[model samples]
Target: MVSRIDYDRDMVQLHEDIQKSKETPIIRKDRIRKSNNNNTNSVHKETLEENIKNANTLHLDNDIYSVYWTDTIPDHIQESHPYIAIMTSNKPDHLDRLILNLLKNALVDPDRILVFNDGVDPVLPILEKYEMTANQLVQNSQTHTKVKGDQNQKDFYINQHYRFMFSFIFDRLHLENIIVLEDDLVLSSDSMGYFTLLSRLMKYDPSIFCVSAWNDNAYLWNSIPDEPLDHLRFSFKRQNHFGGLGFLINNRTYFNRIEPAWREEGANYKPWDTVVQNSMLPEDSCIYPSVPRSQHSPILSRNYKAITSKENEVDEWSFMQFYNPADFFVDGKYMKVYRMTMAPMLQPEYDFNLDRSIRASVEIDSLYAIGFLTTSPHSSFVFYHRVYSDKDKDWELVTKILSLVGIGNGGVVRTVYEGVIETSVLGKRLYIVGFYSKFVFEKHRATKAKMKLNDLIKLVDYGNAHFNEALTKSYLFMLENDHSLHVKVAEQSESCSTHCKTHNFSCKEPYQILLLNSGFVEYSFTSQKYCKTIKIAENSESELGNLPSLYSATQTCVLPNNPSKISCSYTPAKNENVTRKLCICNK
Candidate 1:
């Protein structure tokens, strides 16, 4: 627990620092000064030769940055515990909060916690106050200048920071394992313990590259607070992407594989994390918690808010709504140890049959299913339609479903694990299998079969009254509020499917095509329930022409949930002047 006085003082100092930073120009002189003998409690003075012997030097851009340590590095560093490396960029307030949180919750020696400051001096005071050790790498003032307005330059500098940090940790510090964190994050009480336990798994399994403490889709809406302890907090899954926040990485692989292939310059340069993800071997995968132990605290820094706002063109902050600090949890240190010991034997076997798997999931109280695209040409469509309706390709609908059932969006691809896409719907786990898990499902290829949409709905709808109502209400709400619903004049040569996809949506099959004359009156309804259902027809312009003249003469408005209300007749309307509009109902 951070005391109010400490927090307040830190905030005040942070404000003053920010003001000073804006007013002061970048000083070209070296910022790394020799420690004064006056502050013995917070600083340790050492000769340059001693620094090299202790591996307390960071070489960056042809400059040697001396690492300041509050206490001497132990001669025998424990292999069981990892060095916690925190990266910060002038965010003193965030650094303060993070350090306080770590002190209060993390079961690690303060000497093992290392801070990497990216050419920022304001963080020094906070570090000194806590007597925490850090390495301050100062690039030329020009590098800092380039970062002010150019995103690419900023990315380059950030990549450089990681390069320097990694080199210092693995090459200089001679440490085997490290837990990486950023300043704009707060840890759960069990964060350090979570990583400590999982590090053993990484040691046992060479295929596992990293163990992450973040779940990309662990939003408040997607989390179930009252879920069983094991399924809720202790669950783990293989992740496709490298989740950066609070992740543990070892030095052996870094030196052997990642270091040589690391991107430092050229047109190929990208974000450090992106480069890491791309460089991962096909067999490589990250192990991540089902629920997050570390969360992004964007509100902690004004700079973070400013950067995110400028980059909001991509809707980066849209997922912020799903983040609730209270959702982060870890069962306990004892349980973590037990789970770690049992992890090797707890790996699940793949279920190839969708129907059988779903049935089994229904019987189990808690489950996760990962769906994969089959070799069949229609596999993507079939899986899409069955899990979610074929009406639209909106990923948000899939997200909402997962949220309602209490699940995280495993990573960026949402509900994806070890390349396999995962979600729970109607009390059953569904997976759209990815390439990496082919070994598990490919052998059982002959057993794989698709479940029809109607059959799936029926299976879940049969005695599960609560799930039925919840699913219906949620589905209906999405349909009613869906903005993709639109009217388009029927094209002579184009189909509804092509048209809908043109607008980046999936067509609601059996499109409602309405024919009305100039004098036709449009029907109006206050509620979706009052909206009339129309006859379901094939994807043809002539299907709706069979409707009665009276119905065809008047303009019709149809809601997505209601069935087609247009009464069909064998006779085609003789009226040639009537305008035809195709209603594309997409969710």
Candidate 2:
């Protein structure tokens, strides 16, 4: 809610000011208004943390500036002077209101502007139309990949929304802390004030995360915090803050914690959001609050792209502050941003095949086994119920839970399944242990039919025949249970059989592939069994030392299809003398 000075009256007057300023095409900037000096009206009732941030910052200046813009500027807010950098994206449809509203708010404070083409061609024409200046204008086209039968993959790249948002945050906006905004995002009139307060606050505590704009409530408070910091502050990298419209992150923190993970997840949405919300960090990593100070109410609506002057009466514009809040705040000024304690983790009802089942639909060659539960038939195999990896993901849940045991005791939010362990042995051959496909190219009915006839053949149920060939030669595996599922790799002239290609060995008796089915298999078996199986990553860093692999004891039964009592030392013997060591793959 606004502490109103008559918004309607202000708008009318503003519109009149706009109409009269046609000569300048409606310049919008928070012109340095003379300072508000009534000569110190009252004493400050300073909170402990508040006093800390304020201690370093004396009210050195009191000038205010506001910019008013015409309603026609498109996609991004244009700045009058050079900026740390500019940020805008292709959003042609909302050009009307988005442009104007942005201009109005931006006129508050800004340095420079960076506009993206909104995926449009001939962007300069629009720039010319808006009378905008850009420190840089990034132009590129993005094509969405369409995946059949995959909701997970649908617009999987759409999360590039952050990549688009970050362009300025990285190369352009190099302040100790930076603020990011989206076209359709909403702001609190107090947004600027909050930023100012937070900036000053961070001085004392380098760990205070530049708080975000959205709050999901789940990350609030858990155990009654033990410290007397006064303001209830939670771990920063611990909470689940959703990043869509925007959030502020400290430069140091971004480089240290976020960069690596963001690069790894790269624009995958829901999962990416979950990852961010769950990223792990030490207990002292402070979050002012997890919820964002702003929201994307308009953008969340399907008609978000349609927010233009043609639809709403706003224009494209940006702000230039009397100063970036960075100057006003200190590093450790904690505040009562969050008021509640965190919730305890509740393990779900026991059926562990969730992860196995999620990817089983795509039959993708490899996936991380993120979940597990005890169930019938399978007893206990990994499932996709839920877990976090990719280091940058949200680990607050883990941190908070661990805080219960003791501060800083929490580890990364990952699955503690009976079989998997984070280890050096898998030697970067890290992967999830879940049931994927047993037979490759299931559609080759005749060939597949022949494969099913022999009990020694394994089956992988990837729906796509095209990918099946690659899946068999690649991909890691896990037996679903202790009974040791039987497999029979039939021959090709046995024609077209998945097993006939390169597996040079055939089993005379049904046997199991040593997967995570038996409790006996640990991280090392999983690693040894899945080495060098996946194709080298097409691009990006391909960790050569650990390709996927498969491991199982060469069964006297002729097949290694079951999760039986086979074993490996898990530790690679320090001695170079152990060539015939009980390797998991050769178990």
Candidate 3:
């Protein structure tokens, strides 16, 4: 367990350290100067000092500790290495795990690692053992009390932690670049080497603001398995949004652009990451790997928490298989050079109109089909006419389509491999290509009409034959069944609300009890016809007064059809000579 320290004493020590560092002035090599021009370097140095002074004056929820170093780092090390900044809170166990994983990197330098603690708990001993720098920001008691109840104030404090950390790294330490990591994440063996190679890309490309080690759509259900030869290739794609898990940011970008507009005080608190993302120019973008080099643990924190009362259990076993270092594929040591192509407009080689015969031709690789999308102004759902092509690869065509529909180009486009575009249109999750693709009447054209769901499913089925079998099956199942009626088996002891919540659904009280006949047992819930009548209150025992006995029957919880509801079904054992009672509850 992480032990707590005296907050008052820590604050006093923090104040003394800050004052001492200010009082003692020592001559040091100028590290922040990026340009060779003497006049420009002098002006940049003055601006940096002014920014540091302004940052020190900002209201502090926590005290900032100076970076500790025994000697000046050699010029070669300074030029090639970025200070590794680890942001941590009270989670010592997570911090320990992160440090251990980080140390496993062959290219990692202990002297370059810096821990920025939130000051609730200090792991000074861990830092000492690794010979790493510790910058603990002890919380201010008065500020904490003032921000206790107000959510905006809490967000401000959280945002301020980032401000303080970034300002110290850029303005005070004078580092050119820093790789930021949260304590909850574990780095892959290639993480350091990956960043090292990407750092060159950052220096080479002026338009690229950040390089991230995370693939936003790299979840097991979304990603494709790589072959042995695929491991040798290090592929990266451009994204407008900053993927923040494990990212590298330069001092020039921070001090000049980001720091100036940093939110100091506001009634509505925007997250620091969001502010950074919003501040980027239209030309600026971030580059991230096709496969992630860091894996995030699902431990709850201020930034991440359970959406509902019941904790949703993620399939970590499947997720870990994607992040296994042995399967990382890219040899980071050998992969040093990266050739990044700027925004290249790719015109479709061939475009065909939506039709019934197009499904067979879609199975051919490198085929691009123009699919018509229509949205009912009254509803949140989007309807598609045919198989959707890869949004990112065919962005030029996508832009033209969006222009025709009068929708602007500012919306983020989320891409999943194998010609899939997962997006939320009007608050509803719309899988444009995969299993959820729907047909719509093209009213604007006389020749276009709606296609059957079965036809669309067959297209996806044929197209995804070489893909993961489990994913393909799930996609087919989703397309065949009513999306509103989601059913899953639950423990006999689990409550209706909890069961619904665990499955990412809300629970409505007074669920229905479904009674299934013995002969209909072979059919699934979607196909079987059952007598459902008994209404039971959530979390209460059913009073089967005058009803058939359910002794020796097995119960299964069925999720509601409409957004958040719970329905249950019960089936009797074959050996037990009793009629089976199944209960289903709907909102």
Candidate 4:
């Protein structure tokens, strides 16, 4: 692990500098100095070297201007500068560090910096010493909700933290725009400058709800060679699924649209980020740079384990060269857009309420309906076992066994079993099947057949309750034996119950089919009406091959409780890609 620099040294130095320069309380020049090149400490030297390497393309001198914070708000800033509020509770160490970073990076007016403390008396003296007002909110017995049971106190405090910050900014200060940051947030040298430009963009286009200073995918994108294009790289209207460490909040949209909706929903137990994203105005987006401008510090977090990883840090020299927002456009056109991959689909909720009496027989035969084998249940459902691969484990094991005897074209090893299931519709019946390495089948034949369910009522009820509410018909088939199962949904008047409400998904599309048990998916198109295809490459603009115009669909069966699958129903544009390599969510 690369050792992190001791920020305590820099903080103490900055505090000393501020005390000595009483005439100008702010450290006008550099906030934290880089490590000396001649330092004997090998760890510090390696860290500095790595930092320099990571930010080689930053082009700080060409794009970013030197940060100069005034003791008071400049005339221009009073008219347009955003009200910056830092939310805090009890951690004075984190608060002091954050304030130090702001003094070094942001051109903040002392009056513009409001620290909303949630009844933390210790932080009061610290705030007074800095000449910054700490508006402490009430945390009485009635004010602090009962944070017992499965409820997280950290989440409860965080929700109230936002409520207090926003109320202080819009309701008390009567500010139109504001920047809300946490006590553990650390900003880059050019974070304020970049945010200023983003604010200007948002003012012109109401489509943007807010501007996030941190990009979630910045760490991954930064490692790519010669991409992101420095300050030229920007994301389109991407959703703010996880709240950035620091972000600018539009007073009108957030205070008016989002706040009211969240309040009505009873914002007692929900995360603030989820509330903000879910309650966003129609078609509005949160814009961010390809590289993060601000990041959470590595300090111990109240909610998360660690807010900042090694990858979250930006280069010390990272800065944008643009003097104005107009620099973002060229020749009356905006630059190309970059985006993070869409999140994957949700996992399916299998109907596991059937009888388990057939388990012993199925275990003996080596093949049984996966929907019945509770022990080997997930093995048959490959989509659920994403980490398990036949090529890596199963095939290797089989090969090692065969090669032991100098085997030829390996013969198929079959396992067989028979069981009886009594259903409401179909009375007592005996079923026999064989299991090969990949598929399950009739004891002796090689034929694909639709899965025969003993109880149609149970299947229908399960499909409607768990899969699609308006699914008129469902057909389950053995795609590759019984291990790889396929289920087709037809005559759907609406979408599945778990479709993303944030996305304006239409109900007019046809009901699609899914290979439930298979992890490796290869689509076979029978209809040629839609032929235009597009593929997205990993980096830069490159062709990835094309499939026919297909609508993006999402299923919860793959990653049941996580970010569900994103399907494509239309042809992606030339050089366009999904948010990720696989499990595409959006265009």
Each model's number of backbone clashes?
A: 17, 113, 16, 34
Per-residue lDDT of model 1, residues 1-587, tens digit only: 12235434643454365456542111111222222223222211123223323431122101211112111112332344677888877677888878876765443567777887775446667877777644432233323332575788788888777777788889888888889999888666566656776675444345567888877654322333244544454556675467677888998568755686684445135677766665565445677776677767666542323322321211222222211223334553233222112222112211122222332221111111111111112212212211221112343445443442123222144334433455433222344433333322333443555443333233332243433443342333222334544444333233444555666665442223112211011221212222232432334433332321222244333221112222111122234534332434343
The alpha-carbon lDDT assigned to residue 57 of candidate 4 equals 26
lDDT of 3: 0.42
Alpha-carbon runs more than 4 Å astray in model 1: 1-80, 133-146, 223-226, 263-268, 301-340, 345-415, 426-428, 435-450, 454-587
lDDT of 4 by residue, 68-168 (tens): 22212122323235767777666678887777656643545556677766643466676676676545322332233333445466676667667666766
For model 2, how does the per-residue alpha-carbon lDDT over 1-587 read when each residue is reduced to its tens digit? 11123323543465466457532211123211221223211221122223333432122111111212122212343332222222334454443334443446434233344455434434455544556645445553562223354656543444454455454466565656665555555543334434444444344434344445443221111112122221212222223123334455666656655555566644255544444444434311233232234444344332323222112211111100111122122254422132221110001110112222222322112222211111122222211213333232333333231121111112322322221211110111112221111111234322311111122214333354532332221222333331222223222112111232234432211111222222222322333342222221222322111111122233111112212211211112222221111222211
Q: Largest TM-score belongs to which candidate?
A: 1
TM-score to native of every candidate shown: 0.51, 0.33, 0.48, 0.39
lDDT of 3 by residue, 1-587 (tens): 00113323443454575576653111112212132222232443354344334443212211122211111112232324577888776677788767765664324676778877664565787776666644433233322323455766667676777777788888888888989998887565556656765665444345557878876544322222223333223445555566678999897678656787584344126667766765665445566775676767745331112211123323231132123333222444332333322111000000011122122211211111111011122212223324332223344343232211111122334332223333222122232333222212233223434333443434444343432232233333432342333333333444444556666764332212111122111123424333232222232333221112223243331221111121221222233333333332222
By lDDT, the better pick of 1 and 2 is 1
Mark the 10 consecutive residues where model 2 has the least summed lDDT: 342-351
**TM-score between candidate 4 and the true structure:** 0.39
Sorted on TM-score, best first, the list reads: 1, 3, 4, 2
Judged by lDDT against the true structure, how good is candidate 2?
0.30
Q: Local distance difference test, per candidate?
A: 0.44, 0.30, 0.42, 0.36
